[model samples]
Target: MSIPAALRRRTPRGTPATGRGLRLPVSACVVAAVLLAVVLVPLLVPLDEQAVDMTNKLHAPSLAHPFGTDDVGRDVLLRCVYGLRVSLLVGVVAALTATVIGTAVGAAAGAVGGRTDRMVMRAVDVFSSVPHLLLGIFIVAMFRPGVWPVVISVGLTHWLSTARIVRAELLSLRSRDFVDAAVSGGASRWRVGVRHLLPGVLPQAGLAAVLMVPHAIWHESALSFLGLGLPTHRASLGNMIQDARGTLLAGDWWPTLFPGLFLIVPTLAIASLAGVWRERINPRRRSELML
Candidate 1:
């Protein structure tokens, strides 16, 4: 009379995250926790950026001042925590936008063959000819450097690579026997794309996105370094770097270094986990799963 737990998707035995699974593996859990900490510790800690202690200016890492104070005495730790939030925000937003646009374009190119495909791909080819970081700079240049501008700029520049991958996968997938069978079974083109093909290629798109995040974070920081970044109040890792540049000549590494390290950890974690995430997306992987 007691209800049993629902079986996992195609799981043969273990359920990795469900307590019945592999317990997330020690390394995976640690990495995931580290990524979570990058988002959390800064928010939980109560450090003020504007609270100035001129007496303690340029303090080195010590028992009291772990990350040390900046030239004006702002907590490097607080600024880094705040900067992580902003940098991660921009990266996630921009990547999602690109994913959406790329999915549409790539799916269309695959679904609609002949001249439409040729024209769309030609446009894709054009974007490919331009270097992404240079294009990111130019796009950010066109608009005033702010949160939305960075988000939109980076998102637009990123879709080229995604669109190409999507096209390749969709083209090959649309011709599969199952797809033709679905079409012959009276499914609409949209249905075929959405129900079958879209789901098939979406994992690859996600993988592309996860892989792209580190590069995106780096670019965001680089653009900020170049003064084409967010306002200082916004607290992106790049802005933090900008703030620290003046003090760097005198060797204030703590201010710039710690935020940068936090910025990097998520990018690397997500990138490294991309393969796992992609595999999770595959139906075949479900069959291969042990509980």
Candidate 2:
């Protein structure tokens, strides 16, 4: 017995096909490893008792002080790791918060169209009109300058983009035959929205969340750099850069350079992962790649 020509497997002409289905990108792996180290390494390796060592201050990079010392004599390497942790924490929390809010608003607008959609979209437009950085600064300043304030400010300001993305996704999903069938089968709007519509929107929501992380991180850093985010005492990538501003003129570059690299690497890695994810999720892109 032999297989028919029409049923035979067809290899893509100009591309090599692998047996592996979907593999994580190398950039994602590196980003995950870096995040894991940032979160866990500090817990495992005991920090120096005098992380703020005044006597060892301003020492250049050495085996003892790999990232050199800050103006206040704090170990730059230890502080960098801790700062990375803080930044990552803020970014993840803010992104999650935004995603939740966006999903809720988008779902509501999509499930109930006409006047409700118009109202919600108008509100989104209003929020989008304001410069996010200014809005974040104002929000942070209105309350006391602290972690929660920065988290809330960034989270609130960044939701508009996600909301629009999710709304579009849900609107498209709402018109699908399955959704229509579900509605006709005695499923209430709420039930259909939750059971059918929401599930379909999750993938887009997830991609939006991942893409939001880097933006949130940078937003928090900017706020901190401008002295409106985390307090000066707190170790954050933004504050580290802020602390280095004066030192740059004194011919010392390690303080700013190292922290900047620390910030940039993970951000770029996550963004690359997001691009890969976007391609994976887009039907047209997926189909083109498959060929």
- Using lDDT as the measure, which candidate wins? 2
Poorest lDDT segment (10 consecutive residues) of candidate 1: 7-16
TM value for model 2: 0.87
Per TM-score, the best of the predicted structures is 2
lDDT of 1 by residue, 46-117 (tens): 666657889898888887788888877777776676676667778888888888898788878877888999
TM-score of every prediction relative to native: 0.81, 0.87
* Candidate 1 TM-score, true structure as reference: 0.81
> Going through the candidates in order, what is the number of backbone clashes in each?
5, 0
Error of 1 at 84 (Å): 0.7
Given candidate 1, what's the lDDT at residue 159?
87
Error of 2 at 92 (Å): 0.5
In model 2, where do residues sit more than 4 Å from their true spots?
1-25, 48-50, 184-187, 289-291
